[model samples]
Target: MSWRIHHVSLPTRDVRETAEFYTEVLGMAESSPPWKDQDRGEFDIDLAHVAWFQGENAQVHLSRHSRNFARDNNFHLDPIINGHVAIEVDDLDAVRERLRRKGVYFADPGNWALSGLDQIYVLDPALNAVEINSQLK
Candidate 1:
């Protein structure tokens, strides 16, 4: 399956400040999050606590850390805990099956963060979280 880096999420105490740094200092344009107006009933995160910035083909997501959200959702892999790099794959199911065959533990959170996108989180050897996702057909 083909895959590419979709975005890099960074946890921050202040989303606005971090967003400003990315946009003003880094010359990245502010981008609207796809889940901004969607009904995030399944996720406990508040939209106000997040920001998005775009740089060419990839994006940077700034999120205010919410430990309660992860704990409440009982997510095995917390995507926002220390931040994560998202990879968009052509076939999410294929990737999932591969992970299963490799005996890699991953958290399947589906579309908890964005509409029309199925997402799963896994950890690298260094214990850094990585998000694998695909656009829903």
Candidate 2:
């Protein structure tokens, strides 16, 4: 069976800020405009674009934590949880430098693994962990 990852949800307190973080800071291409489905009338859904590069088939869906859902479902993860979204970049160093110049601080500075790829980990405006690596495969 052939399976593909259509999307992954990233819960954020602010949708616009988080969406812009993925697009502007990480250099991810906006796949499409924000999607709003009225069928799910319980809450307003604002889905931003996604970025899938190389063999990595994944998209980041910025989900607004609805108060209604939280009230009814009573399911929520603490914002400080050690959660992250990883993105592979072609020019890791160049991107890292660009982000740094833009006031994005990296948690791991030039600390790479055996994949022979450099990785820079940072947090988005919503405090969501964002990883930029050179290894996509």
Candidate 3:
């Protein structure tokens, strides 16, 4: 499956401040709606607030916290990292099958709390969290 960059998500202590920094220093403008809360139970995550900043070609998501974060993710560790990048693909089913067959290690694809896109979490070799999302048609 051909992969295209979607966005990068960063877990920060303060979402507003992080967005401000990106907007003021990096010149990223708020692309999506204002920050809001999330209500999903996947990966033991309960995001309180999230915001997205738009750059010239990509997007950045900032979140305050995730309650009950994943404890046994691919790296067998809680996602204590930042700048989690995302990739979008049209054929999610094929990608899932390929990843499963190769034993590449990934999570079950599920709809996000607010954004109903189907997404799966996969960790890179360095244990960096990567979100693979798709809005299946």
Which candidate number would show the highest lDDT if scored against the true structure? 1
**Model 3 segments beyond 4 Å from truth?**
33-48, 55-57, 71-80, 114-116
User: Model 3: per-residue lDDT, tens digit, 48-107?
Assistant: 366666666567778765444554333343433565788888878887898899889887
Minimal lDDT window, size 10, model 3: 34-43
For model 1, residues 25-130, the per-residue Cα lDDT tens digits are 9887877677723564444345468888777778888888776866777787678879999999999999999999999999997876776889999999999999
Q: Which candidate gets the maximum TM-score versus the true structure?
A: 1
Comparing 2 and 3 on TM-score, the stronger one: 3
- Best-to-worst lDDT order: 1, 3, 2
Each candidate's lDDT (Cα)?
0.83, 0.52, 0.66
Worst 10 residues of 2 by lDDT: 46-55
Question: What TM-score, computed on C-alpha atoms, does each candidate reach?
Answer: 0.86, 0.38, 0.71
Error of 1 at 123 (Å): 0.9
Q: Against the true structure, candidate 1 has what lDDT? A: 0.83
Q: Which prediction has more favorable lDDT, 2 or 3?
A: 3
lDDT of 2 at 51: 25
